[model samples]
Target: MIKKAVIPAAGFGTRFLPATKAVPKEMLPIVDKPNLQYIIEEAINSGIEDIIIVTGRNKKAMEDHFDRSVELELLLEKTNKHELLNTVEQISNLVDIHYVRQKEPLGLGHAILCTKKFIGNEPFAVLLPDDIIDNEEPALKQMVNHYNDVQSSILGVKEVPHNDVDKYGIVEIEKSSTSLYPIKGVVEKPAVDVAPSNLAIVGRYILTPEIFDKLENVKPDAKGEIQLTDAIESLRFDQSIYACALEGTRYDVGDKFGFLQATFDFAMKREELHEPLKKYLKEKLEE
Candidate 1:
């Protein structure tokens, strides 16, 4: 029962630039709701009860978004805005969310290490909120189901084009099934000539606590940042780690193009926005 999940939201979104100067990237809204909220909802839907969000400076907005506001609720009630009120109220009650500040700008592995006190000896899921996954089955839930059967760490993997393999952490897999692969090796952003496979590691992960020990032994790179990929690779020495191919569309919302694509896809799915957005896209295409 992997009841706890950790979300690393501390990164400085230099990719988004000026807009992210003050606002945390996780707070960036997808349509009307913040991206982090969607990630939280995904966790809740996957039966995750305890959520530990690893945040950094100027991340109060992320915290506030999940907190209850009595005045706002009362005002909504007075205005008879039941729908809006329910939406606002539901955010606070979705799950047991806890926040921990990552005082410095460390790497993904460090941010996850911060949750050791909370996670304490439990196998936990790590959801990078930026990788918004849309599927008939929530991505994390699918990973969890697979985790139950394998009882090993699972990494969400998706097939990328051979040309794009250099842009991602490519996995060297041995025995491969239709939806799962036994990860024999992992290289972070390898050159095309050296890429062992086109299976790229994505954001979602179900990690065992032994990873903490591996992370502690990991040396920081030239940028003075620890790489989670390195730690996971080190853990491979002790146990079997698998790459579970996701049965869904994954949008790397941290990237500008990916964000726009996700917004358009999600919007098109809405009944009210479908026709209007489709008409607007057709009009723009004509120009």
Candidate 2:
């Protein structure tokens, strides 16, 4: 059973710009809660017990969110705000949260590699905070449940348009079933003329212990940092890689325009804010 998950949060969200200079991109507000909270909630809902977050410098606010704020709790208790208390308490109740400093802004592969001591010999999960899936079936859980049956490394993949394939890690599928497929190999940002398929690997993975060894020998290719996709490719022959296109609408919050769209959609999901938000957006459109 995949009971552990590692979320890499050390990336410099340059796309978000000056705002992100002080604020961590993962902590950006979605609707009622911060963005990282949603991702953390997803991990907790998926029955993941040990949640490891690989964070870096100036990211102390991320840790503080998970940690208990004693004074704030007492203030809420005094005011008899049961709802607020319950909401604040949910953070602690969610999971056994652990933090490991990535030390430097390496790469996603290095972030996962840092959790070796905590992971030990178990199959762990890696979720990218940038990819937020809106669905009843959590993306990681979907992949892990499938991995439980197959007992092989599984990646959360979704079909993209032919042109957009170059923007992501495109999977070369050997065979295809309904929701799952046997991925032959993956090409990171392949050119349009020589592209394989439209299926792109998203931000979810259930990887075995072999990946750790592969990551150790995996050099920083052309990119200065270790890429996880490279390590994933090296494990191809030894094990089969199954791609599961999860039943969810993925919003790439990392993109500027996508982030704006997500903010509007997520706000519309809120009961109190829906009508008002729509009205305001309509008014703005008219202006």
Candidate 1 lDDT by residue in tens digits, 1-287: 88999999998999998999999999888877788988998999998999999998888998889999899999999999999999999988989999998888878889998999999998999999889999989999989999999999999988888999988878898776467778899898999888999999889999999999988889988888788999999999999999999989999999999998888898899899999999998999999
TM-score of 1: 0.97
Question: Residue 179, candidate 1: how far off, in angstroms?
Answer: 1.4
Candidate 1: C-alpha RMSD to true structure equals 1.0
TM-score of 2: 0.96
Clashes of each: 0, 0
Candidate 1 wrongly placed segments (more than 4 Å): none
Clashes of 1: 0
Best by TM-score: 1
Best by lDDT: 1
